[model samples]
Target: MKSLKITIALLLTAMLLACAGNDELDGLTADSGEQQMYDQAQRYLRNRNFSLAVRGLQLLESRYPFGRYAEQAQLELIYAHYGAYEHEAAVEAADRFIRLHPQHPSVDYAYYMKGLAAYAGNTDLFARFLPTDVSSRDTTHAREAFAEFSQLVSRFPGSPYAADAKARMVYLRNLLARHEITVANYYFRRGAYLAAANRGRYVVENFQRTPAVADGLAVMAQGYIMLGMNDLARDATDILALNFPDYPALDDDGNLSSDYSLEEGQQRSWLNRATFGLFDPPEIPQFDTREQYE
Candidate 1:
């Protein structure tokens, strides 16, 4: 009996609001109605009906742009867009909220979501885990994601999202570092010795702690050797052997022994197989070697 009364009351309220909406889009945006609509949207959000939640929030914002719940509705709208996989819209909404309420206590949440949107906005979700060299790929979104996360961490160390933001930043930095190494390797393959060497040097200079540093050192040494810069080659070789003792670039005597050549580095390429394109490649390369990057 109580449930029936509540249902009838809600129906009447909706009918009243609809009539009020006809008079002015926000004519029903009184305090009581605003709370009711916002509460209904919260229910939709809790039910994971993000589309419905989005509609409710949109109505809340449009009807009472300056309502007490307007800011909170905008925040919820961002989440609704994100939950629905509307990544670009989520980011745009986040940006708008941040701009409008720079001093709002919840601004850090907006920043965090901005980074999350970019991180998850890659062309394919699987691409994030693919073995293809990132240097040959478009990493603009990744870089932007990193920047957003970085800002949140740096500006709000105590933010609830700070720890996760730091971890993500580390991953992005490593990814960017590896990209340089891959590009260097590709240049070496294309017989652009100078470009390859320069790329290796960039990684060494910019990305020290990453695993790519070992490869960078090897590429640099090989590039110098091929370019007839024996002294520089020797320096790179020595440093690599010293730091990464088990590195494949080193020989039994802990000396640079292998001639790093593009022809030498061709192992199974994910890009080549992806030509198989998820269904099956026309030909899959034999053997998956972990150390194939050498």
Candidate 2:
């Protein structure tokens, strides 16, 4: 009985979608042809009815591939998909527009929209309110977003969107740097000294000037100490002290302090240990983070 009900519900949804599509098609039957459909889509978009806008735009494109409204319809489809939070569809539409009209003046906007969609695609409703570290999560969309933004800035320096694209690239670069630092911290805490130190070196080399570089150096020094490489550890510590004198990991002698130890992380209060950190919550690692988005 439950299975039958679910099947019936799915059939109803399909039928409703078919009917909606027909209604949009029927509305475009006026003698004005492509203009009528395009106008209808514009109205839906202005009213923020993205679903209807998407349907109308899709119809306009299919029915008038070479019509005067075809190019505009394709561009609007990208915006419609983005507003509806269909990020993949938005990116695909943007790519299609750019491919078909590479030299068009508005192609820059398409590239910008693609990058924006990819970035927002990584955002979740809850994370908007809570303090979440997006970099520590899956980086596929973040990397994609970064690449798109970089392309826009490199190809269209004087374009109005280029400045904003550059700003977003900064944010994305810092996020990637912080991700590597976080991973290195995990290896450090787990006593995998070589793994931890390599991650720290990667951040310093690949993501220079980001705020996370200080922590990366700290991780590198600590990892080297655990592996009994005193000279290397001292070198990392000295550079960190020179660049970030106020860094918390520095001691009075300007050497890396021994505070970031697995022992410190494991020494929980008796109350927390008995309750498995329920009574006294285990401390999440803290890093000096930088936020450029205002």
Candidate 3:
């Protein structure tokens, strides 16, 4: 019964979508050729009427898939979806265009658009309006965008979009590395030294050129020290000193500062736990590895 109800709901949703699509096409009647439809979609796009543009472009593709405007219409649909904030749809449209026209002259644009869509997907309305810490949030879309941009750069190094893609890739890499550091910091604060060390090690291994590597090494060293692994801690500090001598955690004498010492029996106050550690927080050893976003 539940399955049948779900199926019914899906059918109703499809019907509503069909009706909405038709409504979006309002006075724009289909002409004899795809050119007219494509033109109308372009007009809608120019006016930022993304809903109308998406419907008109989709209609053009369906009515005249082999027409001269068919490929261009498909490409335009991707932009229309992106403009409408339909990021997943935009990515799918871009992917379809790339798969169908791999050798086409404008295929690089499809790749660029795919990366752009995924990049935009990572930023939600809250992040746009509020001072949210994006690095502390889920990084699924960031990783996806990084991979997409990487593919674009690898395949079309000379393309016009390659430079911008490279810039965004750098940002994403830093964001990803910072996210790992944030997790490591959380684990360290919560007394999970081994887990924190592992997270820091992951950042050092995977994100070499990112600014977060210094912080990662700091975390690994402090976390290992907390776990009584002095040898491992020394190794981490040595590497940090070699690669990033200016690391904030290092003392003037080139040794790990005594500030990050772990207090074995430090307990959180009731007020601290009640406020989620915002007020009257525990005196845990923390490294300020939050590198400013590049």
Query: How far out, in Å, is residue 166 in model 3?
Result: 1.2
Write model 1 residue lDDT over 1-294, tens digit each, in one string: 686687678768966764554353223343437788888789878977676677789888887899899999999898888886788999999999999999999999999999998877765643533355455577788899999998999889999999999999988888887778777766654455678789889989998887778888887887786677889988998898898887765787876664442232242245534543233222211111126432
lDDT of each: 0.75, 0.79, 0.82
Give stretches of model 2 more than 4 Å off.
1-32, 125-131, 261-294
Enumerate residue pairs that collide in model 2: none
Clashing pairs in 3: none
RMSD each, Å: 11.0, 7.3, 8.0
Candidate 1 regions with alpha-carbon error over 4 angstroms:
1-32, 125-136, 259-294
TM-score: which candidate is best? Answer: 3
Ranking by lDDT: 3, 2, 1
Tens digits of per-residue lDDT for model 2, 140-224:
7889999999999989999999999999999899888888877776554344568878988998889888888887887788777
CA shift of 60, model 1, Å: 1.4
lDDT of 3 by residue, 1-294 (tens): 686687678768956775676475656555646667877888889988787789888889888989899899989899999988889999999999999999999999998899899988877753654578888889998888989999989999999999999999988998999899888878765666789899999999999988888888888898888788989998999998998887777898778876775543454566766665466655666665555423
What does the lDDT read for residue 196 in candidate 1? 76
**How many steric overlaps are in each model, in order?**
1, 0, 0
Q: Give the TM-score of candidate 3.
A: 0.83
